[model samples]
Target: MAVNKLVYYIIPLIVLGLIAWWQFGFGGLFENLKGGVKGVIEMAPNVSIGAEEELATEPTIPREHEEAINNLVETIEKMVTSPKKNCFLNYKLLGKNYGTNSGMPSLGEGGTTISFQLKGDKTEMLIAGGAGGKQEVTRLRKEIAGFKPCVIAGSNEITKNFFNRYLGQGQILGDNYKPVSIINIFYDTDGDNGNAIRVPEFGNEPVNDEGDNFEDEGWLFKAEDGSICFFPTNKVMSADDDGLVYGNINQINTKVGVVGSGLDYCYTWTE
Candidate 1:
């Protein structure tokens, strides 16, 4: 009888011990395991830390304008640098035009016209006029021929070759070379009494015979109609030959109004 009683007592104690282990001891073990897993996660790569910073403010231009500008820049870059497309040329106009009654001067008040006299590896007469008089228009057409299509390439080798031929060698019409003319126009839209823009200086002195002048400087063209334009004077050669012109367009700041409306923009090219 005593033996039976002792066995019963020992079995109950063992059961109690197992239950305690399953409840408290096992729970503690699982918690330790979970903590170890969390530590591993903390030690893992901080992928988010290497991400680029987000912009503090979003872009102001409409998506369409942004896209159009981007396309224009890309096209210009390809024309400048593409070995195949080296024969092509590009131009751009900046600023906006508001109605006369809107308190903004007409396009005539601005030098909104551009002309070119190109002669080189390829011969062609080409002309593009701004919003002003037919004199600028007619003269521009008489001076140049129709534009030729050039191949567009993305490789640096192709771009280098195009730059060498078009810009470096001046081969647009064989050997005879002429100066490239760039015209800019600016307009004041707000009618702010003292709002006037000074032409930025540009030139290549003692370097090339092209009679480099203020127009040669990379400038932002703002039309009296409030159109903002940018010409890649500094990077024109490279931009035309390379396929990466869009990158430069993104660098422009359009907040500086010419007249007022920022929606006015235009561009063209000659070669």
Candidate 2:
């Protein structure tokens, strides 16, 4: 029994020694491994240059070059700032620049807005025009779907058709049929075709804006091609009280896709 137990233990020892010899080399395997690990540890710091070991130097620009840079910076600063806007002059709108007139004139004394006389539906337009420009809505709605700034496409003809249908009354007739008008005088003009107007400029006066303050009311007609502008006036007006006028191109539409005919009776007074 003792001899059998010794044989079993000796067999396991022999198998383990063979496995170790096969995995490692014959004798100095552990010593070689220890030397390799030590070599890697010793070489690591030399291979990697850390942040503390980095060398940095300040850059120095020549005097003339530095001056030139400063001047260029100043020029850039000025370019970034817009020329002071004069309310009495034309403005390059940053928005879509639809260039439609705002129905309200800039009146510091009173805030203004545009109100459309809604037909509720196309049937009302047919009843109102009695064969005037009701068909214009078909084309007009198509135009309105594609609105963008400064695009003068089919707007002129549409404007004409719209004006042919509706007269340039200041305020839209309310639910009542009574002729409601603006407190000021409105304008009357001929038809619309390829007309252009430099939009009227009023001094920008800050509004109290406690509530009832609006700069203007206008209409926007966009085309499927993303073309549109603002029409502030109900009708195409040739003149303002200040004798300034934006041509009929700015004539938005009536209650349809566009607005009414011309400028409403608004006096732009400063507060």
Candidate 3:
């Protein structure tokens, strides 16, 4: 009877212990314990710990050279965003001294070059040049080709096309269309000829010498050779505010391709 009573008490205690463990065990308890230990350790400071300490040095601020470079960068950025006339004026000033025709033979011919000695890093100098003329522009473009900048080059026509066609726009357009119109159409297309022809709605036909029916419902047609041909449109063509006209050709049942006809081809109508 004594042993039975003892076992009864022991069993109840063990059951209670198991219940407590199940209710308040594992992650919560471990986290609490870890936090408490960390708190205590943090409170107990000045404990000798062996660690490699970097030799203390005075905090270095931007040197005059770096400041000058930064200022130049800012100026270039602002000039790029400014009005075309203002940009041209500034470009002229830069071009005058460093320009291709500038009397300085060291600066090369046809392009404007600007050279400044870095203020802090006195050993090195920074030279930047831009060419607006056709030959110089070509040379500059060739030099920068395949070069990637730490700071992304701001959007231009080429960059915009890359994003809209090469990157995310491909996925978006693919999802929306069954036979997705390839943005590659902007470039070359098989059976389209040399390139897509662009004819102005108000101006003369693109190919003046080649005699064709100009009055007929002319189309800015993409030839099978991947060439674009511009023809006159006899009928009234309507365009949206965005300047995109959506339409279909008789041969192709589905709508495909687009036409830009406004000033500088500003209007783009996609079908």
Question: lDDT winner among the candidates?
Answer: 1
Superposed Cα deviation of residue 247, candidate 3 (Å): 55
User: Which residue ranges in model 3 land beyond 4 Å of their true spot?
Assistant: 1-52, 55-62, 85-271
- Give RMSD (Å) of candidate 3 vs. truth: 25.3
Clashes per candidate, residues 3 or more apart or on different chains: 46, 35, 26
* Candidate 1 per-residue C-alpha lDDT over 9-46 given as tens digits, one digit per residue, 9 for 90 to 100: 99998997787678769878578666776565456523
Model 2 scores what on Cα lDDT? 0.27
Worst 10 residues of 2 by lDDT: 121-130
Q: Could you give candidate 3's per-residue lDDT for residues 29-107 as a string of tens digits?
A: 5776666765655565433223311111111212322332344343333333333210011111232232111112222
lDDT of each: 0.31, 0.27, 0.25
> What 10-residue stretch in candidate 1 is worst by lDDT?
205-214
Per-residue C-alpha lDDT of model 2 across residues 20-99, encoded as one tens digit per residue: 77888776667766667656645663332334122121223233223322332232222223232111111122242222
For all predictions, the C-alpha RMSD in Å is 21.2, 26.8, 25.3
Model 3 TM: 0.15
